[model samples]
Target: MTTALTQQLVDLPVIEVLYSDLDNTLLGPEGSLLTGPDGRPSARAAVALVDAAVGGLTVVPVSGRAMPQLRNDARLLGLSDAIGEVGAVILRDGRTQYEWGECPGGIARNPHDTLTATGAVDAVLDAFPGELRPYEPWHRGREGGHLFHGVADVDAANDALAAAGCGWACLRDNGRTGGWEGRSVRAYHLLPRGVGKAPAVADDLAARGLRPEQAAAIGDSVEDLTMAPQVGAFFMVANGHDAPGTIRTPGGMGEGFADAVLALLAHRAGATRDNRQAPAPAEGTVVPSTVLVVEDDEMVADVIRISLTAEGYDVAHVTNTAAALSTIQASPPDLVLLDIMLPEVEGWEVLTQVRSQPHTAHIPVVIMTARTMPADEVRGYNLGASAFMRKPFTPDELLAQVDGVLQDTPRA
Candidate 1:
């Protein structure tokens, strides 16, 4: 059943700036950008986000993701600012600020290092035993908190930290996932005692010189609800647990987040007469972003297609520059993943033509090549390549490249 809009929410003042969570709120399951809550191709969230951007709303992603990761995401989503690492890292005004909320461990250097030196992470892990482990692969890059994947008794973990003489530390419940241990588990970040989403948000509000009435936040977890007091109000996606001052929006996942966005748009100055102007696709709608992969290798093309498809992007593959150009002329893609080594004509030729053309000059192009020569990168960049990605890149690296280029282009 749909939850009718509350008069209380409708009566609130216009929301000029919106702070939204990333993983399971602005995005769908497992951070799939194009997928809807029903696990189908949908641009509901992306459309709403773009509308908010075009309609003059300052949208900032607030999440527990790493700073660099969030920056890439912010760019891909056509946003400029974000609150990452559960508010531990704040990216504002072209700089990253680490807001280490008063830790007993002196702030002589990196806060994450100071927290690590206290051994609180180890203590939490040891206390939970097999139930806890560092969230693998990406966890090593975190500077905000020691991200862990487990079924953690948060209070018990805090007790362990305090017992270990690290009374200035605590555990934050990020969210739930089934990516490990063959069972659903929660994501936890061991952070400083006083540092959390709320305090971080309050600090950002002060920096922006905006009153609480001008701001609103939306998120899917209990950690997200903490931002309520810092903003004029907080809207929880239908998937999130309820809290005292939270209002649950309709739909689920990305669509639900978009609904909340639509609600705010109703009160904005440049908002449309009907805030639901960009609704979800009915049955066979196109994905929001389309990426064309131009690679000669079938294995490479397949890998690229699969990776992009999994991320909820529409992908078209062409093994040669001839087919690639044909596809481009037939239907212009949002971005091009071009390969340097192509049949008959080199990929550089395609890049040059694409850059010089009037109709397609604005489309961002990413050059992929195994050529390690310095001149190759220089030539690619000179030819207007948005990004020159070295060959043999992991899927993560490829996505990062795509994201970085799109961040600079209006097509994003």
Candidate 2:
């Protein structure tokens, strides 16, 4: 049934937030989602938070782990929306939503055995005997993929696996997947050739009546790196493992995850209001410091709202840039959170118009987006943005960047 909270969210715009990496990115090192838990997420709290965001926008947890195992956790966590196996499998509302790259013909014979699911893994292990370790299934009645605990030569192992039956291959980053009777550990996400998180989440969104721009993907590993660039925002939680161009979080485990979620929620909150009067003259800006956050994703918009509200900023969040532009001309906000993908007019065109206008040109615009390419960043900055930041950032960080810019304005 639609709860009161859900009803409230239904009225607001939505932004989807896709979190990758259960070990640390979503939970903690130990897979706990609670605050006091050593590893991070305790599972129960994770479900509650997700439940709260359901009607507004979907909260999808994407992981590289096997589907069944993650499914079990999903059941335990009550994650109505989840994607597993680096996006090869998907489950929503506790039901198997979709499975891709698993050829029906190849699996038609086995039916019961998921062995066909581990073709790429088997091939990689066969080519490099000593480098790969195979682990038994984590559950019964299931023939799962073999885990490679420690490999002396990753490059050699990958080359060998390439020649094998063909599937996805990922270097292990977490040591949880026990291989070789629990000898060593590393990060990995090997899967079928066509399988990946972007496709999986994208498919999930399509099924749910959402789009890529309506969602945000968060991760801290190579697998996520492959998917992050495609979403509205690719948040890289700073949990030690580093990637170039990634927005680093201040803390580790739950702190980093919470920080990112909070930032996204702030965006959502900022965009919820229908009529946002700019900040009072005393607050600065002749037209009032109103904001228009243009985001179609509910989860993202909610997070953005939380952040913007916390800063004592008033905002009007909208979905389409075209509608946002019309509103701007009618009543402009002091700032705009423009996403590149939008109906009718793209975010770039919106930015061009914002800069070209005589009245709106001087308004401060912060490009809060997930476009990570250097060219994108350069383009955002070149377009006269006060600040440009990729998605999945912490609210404090986003606020800091915005506050720094607004502080430069002469207070009215």
Best by lDDT: 1
Clashes of each: 0, 60
lDDT by residue (328-388, candidate 2, tens digit) is: 8898776777777676777887788888988888777778765678888888889887788
Off by over 4 Å in 2: 1-14, 35-55, 97-99, 102-125, 129-131, 137-146, 152-190, 274-412
lDDT of 1: 0.76
The true-structure Cα RMSD of candidate 2 reads: 16.4
Evaluate all candidate structures by whole-model CA lDDT and list the values in order: 0.76, 0.59
**Per-model TM against the reference:** 0.60, 0.54
Query: lDDT, candidate 1, residue 69?
Result: 84
Residue 87, candidate 1: alpha-carbon lDDT: 86
> Residues 210-325, candidate 1, lDDT per residue (tens digit)?
88878899888877887888888788888888776677777678987777766665444212222324334335433447899998855456546644655567888888878888
User: Model 2 reaches what TM-score against the true structure?
Assistant: 0.54
